[model samples]
Target: MTLPAFELVQPRSLRDAIDALAAAPGMEPIAGGTSLLVDLRGARVKAETLLDLGRIDELRGITIDSHELVIGAMATIADVLKNPAVAEHAPLLVEACRLFASPLVRNRATIGGNLAYASPAADAAPPLLALDAVVELRSVRGRRQVALAEFFKGVRKTARKPDELLVGIHIPRAVPGTLSAYRKLGLRKADSISVASVATRVVVDMAGRCQAARIALGAVAPVPLRVAKAEAALTRHGLTVEAAADAAKLAAEATSPIDDVRGTAAYRRRVTETLVKRALLELVEKGGDGR
Candidate 1:
């Protein structure tokens, strides 16, 4: 199908790209173009200009800075899947990336686009939310950082101002004792949107007592969510069958699943609870990333 009339900007620098976005009357930035191409062809996202950001050197790949693991917005899912630092420091993300589309799409799909689009069933958001990730956003005027918890506003919605470009994703450095995992319920795994997704990250003391816990869920609410009630139940508890089961119940309470073509809200709710149990129990029984 022929695309509509659109001007293209190929900026050599991020500053030039920002200016281009600010100046275009109806401009949108694109990387990979996987999602936007569909929207543009369907006439769902009307834009007279497309600011392509694929060449921006500053916005790509993975790095372990002194303070955190910095991931550029333009980094492809495949890049993430193969990066050793990401696998070592943030395996939860690696796990999620493993389940995102296929090798063909992963080679093109970017973290920035996925989080910016903010689909409720997106595999990345829950794990990032559980990791306490931060996103760096830039506008013509300045830059700001927002925690992932405050990022997603609703289904297909986010806190981003229209002019802001999501520049990078920031994840805390993984240290010893930090344990994390990601779980997704897809119809048959390949090319399936999540029926339910959950991510759990916990730090256990040498004696096996939980020192910290974070539980985030997706495909059950309008946005990926942290189950505060579930986290509370785990932080001081032991890593055991009973503790995992109890946290799963709290996670179920925090969800507000809706009936959809994928499954009934009730079904989604139950699966979320089960997924949480599996994640936590798997951690207890098997230890860290099966790697």
Candidate 2:
């Protein structure tokens, strides 16, 4: 199907993009056009104008500043895989990128577009959530930062206002002794959306005791979620098989899944429990080397 006719506006600067959004109703921002184009073609979404952000250089790089990794909203999945800063600061994000889609799609799919599309199965959200990432939103009024946990309001919905543009994502640099891992269970080995996914970050001391844990789940909830009960089960405890099992059970219990073409709620819950346990056990065995 062909996309509906719409006016395209290419803004040369970030400020110009913001102004365009503020001035026009029914103006939708387009980064890579990977998801938006498809939505438009299918008539799932409609817009009178397209605000192309590709030319705005301000929204297209990855940098580290003051102990945080700042990724420009326009950075593509391929860019994430290639950037040394991303690899060093957030390797689990790389894991997600590798599993995002085909190479062709990865090259054109911007990180901002992925998050903005707001799919429960979005590969980027779980890892970013586990890393305690924050998204920066800008508008004519001012700029505000929203925690990744609070970014997604519901299915295909986000906290971004109509006139606000997502400019960047900020992630705190992982501290020493922090181990992280990501797992996605897709129907196909490649190029398939997740049936259920899990990302984990565990901070452990040399004594093999857990100081902190963050377990984020995707595709099994209305939004990507950090299972606080599961994290609490592992926190301040020995990283033992028993603890992993208990935490896994809690994680599974927290999910609110629905029966979809890809999977049933029961299947998703079982996968979530298994993946969480496996990730925790792997972290314990590797002793902070979650490669």
Q: Which of the numbered candidates is closest to the native, going by highest lDDT?
A: 2
Q: Which stretches of candidate 2 lie over 4 Å from their true place?
A: 288-291
Assess candidate 1 and give its lDDT. 0.86
Against the correct fold, how does model 2 do in TM-score? 0.96
lDDT of 2 by residue, 1-291 (tens): 667999999999999999988998468889889888988999988888899999999999999987899999999999999999899989989998999978999998999988888989888999999999999999999999999999999998999999999999999988888888888999998888899999999888776668789999999999999999999988845567778889999999999999999999999999999999998888777683222
lDDT of each: 0.86, 0.90
Screening candidate 2 with a backbone cut-off below 3 angstroms (N, C-alpha, C), the clashing residue pairs are none
For model 2, the run of ten residues with the poorest summed lDDT: 282-291
Q: How many times do residue backbones clash in model 2?
A: 0
Instruction: Write down the worst ten-residue block by lDDT for model 1.
Output: 282-291
Count of backbone clashes, every candidate in sequence:
0, 0
Error of 2 at 213 (Å): 0.7
Q: What lDDT tens digits, residue by residue, belong to model 1 across residues 13-88?
A: 7898888777763567888788888878998888877888898988996899877999999999999998998998
RMSD of 2: 2.0
CA displacement after TM-score superposition, residue 55 of candidate 2 (Å): 1.5
